[model samples]
Target: MQKIISASNFADIMGVSKATLQKWETNGAFVPSIDPAGRKFFYVEKLLGVPEISDMVQSSWEEEMQVNPLRSYTSIELFAGAGGLALGLEKAGFSHILLNEIDHDACVTLQYNRPEWRVVEQDVRTISFKQFNGKVDFLSGGFPCQAFSYAGKQGGFNDTRGTLFFELARAVKEIQPKVFMGENVKGLAAHDGGRTLETIRNTIAELGYTLIEPRVLKAIFYQVPQKRERLILVAIRNDIADKVQFKWPDPYHRIMTLRDAFFKGELYDTDVPPSEGQTYPLKKQKVMELVPMGGYWRDLPLDVQKEYMGGSFELEGGKTGMARRLSLDEPSLTLTCAPAQKQTERCHPTETRPLTVREYARIQTFPDEWKFAGTLSSQYKQIGNAVPVNLAYAVGRSLIRLFNDIESL
Candidate 1:
């Protein structure tokens, strides 16, 4: 079957620039199949020859969606921001025994949504996990990535001291859950010339767990309408690790777009509800008005581009995020803490303004009913810092499948 995709989406998948894709079409290397709306798209079948792209389009997402835990599985999440991952795990049939966060606003948001949850609001360093030792099935968190000082020869658990990762490792040492997953920005994989990830692997081994091959998952492939990427580190307690294999979740059959996020569609049953959003200054508004949908700073007039980009205009990189307006036909660019910030603008497609709070939530696959607590900026930070709910759900289902296999064994 022929599955159509937009030029930008295809480019992103192919690891080429839109200009490069355009060049290919111009040179007759490959032709795009146009849809009824006169938009260009490529056939999914044609790209199946490429291994990386093939894995994405050939999906078992529907089958994976039916995955359920063999029995009730308990989880304790550290650094739980706004409950995005927690909610996804719950949907995948895991019961949370505890959710910990240091941010007051994020804690309030979690309590507001699920009062029954044991939401612990405090620094993770002060918390004790010994009480839940051997009682939890999973422990998960998105510990902030920090450079480990390789001053000593030992690159084990103690070496990670003073970093947030040390706290996460401490929880694992105490709780000894069957499985634990750590999520972080994709850059974490290559941070500090790969020493950081190496230390993480070594530390997991020291904790008596077998580290699975870590992977970077693209959120767009997991039913989230954003181009965010996260590095996932999953480990199985050594005893259980010997008996079973962990399979990553299948990518969805198709990429969701901002259109699906905003409208009543497969992703959401209702249109994005109105909510507070930031406003651009008069000068900035006028500059953004000239940029077209899916266009960035480069789309502005030559003089405006210089003025808007300032010194960065002469920088070498594409710098595509500046003065950017989202396109309805494509997944949103990864969101940041503030939508109207000059370096990472997320202007609405047709509105000539920043995306509303609800719109930001929608792009991250947050349910319309999941209310965030905080000032407007704090709300945005909580949402922006969160793992996209759908991406987390996909991973959660895979974890459920792993647990089910372990149960059978």
Candidate 2:
């Protein structure tokens, strides 16, 4: 027989507050088992089919926009991954003329939800930008950062050949869009001792674009429920550079919590719907079951800790991710592709397992109805790689401000 966990215990296992659990239950985000004594309990089976609540929130935003519309602009996206950024832009009033993505599954996911979007599935290198030249108002991508070889000279555009950044620059050069935005892991700012980013700046300048001082945007500050960060780089074509002084979007007053993500509260009206999820093996599950809320391997008994940590027990730094459980009081740690991947485990606050697929999507601010394509692992990977939808919406709003200045000029 499966053991039942109380609502508080389950919330502890899932790393959420008891208040959050109660709110979710009240909102119909989740329905736990009720005993004859009127006590709320959660079963392992109940955890299996958590619904995608983020989609419901996003749909509400879409509905709100239809009633109180925003200014419209045209955009072309490169390296589009799973449509997170594109969808956020759409919500902010950007009409995408074309979206290019190399991954088959991601492209399929984009098309599956928004069939009206021009989903161009091809290697970005092979595509010509002549058609969009001088027409697109905005171009955007989350380009991968690669070090320039330098070749014993000042690194220039040619030295960046074979890297995805070059393709991004090539697109900007060809399209001459009024503005372009590029995003990457925050580490890109200091990559290659900052020389890589300097080269990118010079390259953009060579293409007659003025670069903004790149800044790392914190997702938590931008209404995302997780503590993820992305480095953003914006460039304005020389023709429009002086016309607008772009302002990054203001941070929301209240920070969103993991509870807000998975349950029905301030983030959504309806509770998360049931969906599929991954499970831990017997041995791992047994070990995780012993961990208390907000605890990790260090909290385990000494002998068990040594066995679970292996040689890592003697390592220097705190292996925080190892056996780590979340805390309900704070924002969740940055989510990864595999919730249960070794060395990066994201155990639930009160539960003995990793978060479900719907929970993962909610953390990334994906809308509930935005279905992912491919297998479970693929879905996780796609969500992990995406920009948080709300973060993208804030960025889109800022872009709109920038474009408005250009139009004024």
Q: Which candidate is the best by lDDT?
A: 1
Model 2: lDDT equals 0.81
Model 1 lDDT per residue over 277-373, tens place? 9898899899989999899998999999998888998889988888999999889999999898877889999889999999999998889989999
Looking at model 2, report the run of 10 residues with the lowest lDDT sum: 50-59
lDDT minimum window of 10 residues, candidate 1: 1-10
In candidate 2, clashing pairs total 22
> Model 1 residue 390 lDDT?
92
Writing each residue's lDDT as its tens digit, candidate 2 over 183-255 gives 9999998899999998998889988999988988878766788888899999998877876798776655445
Q: Model 1: C-alpha RMSD to truth?
A: 1.6
Candidate topping TM-score: 1
True-structure Cα RMSD, model 2:
10.5
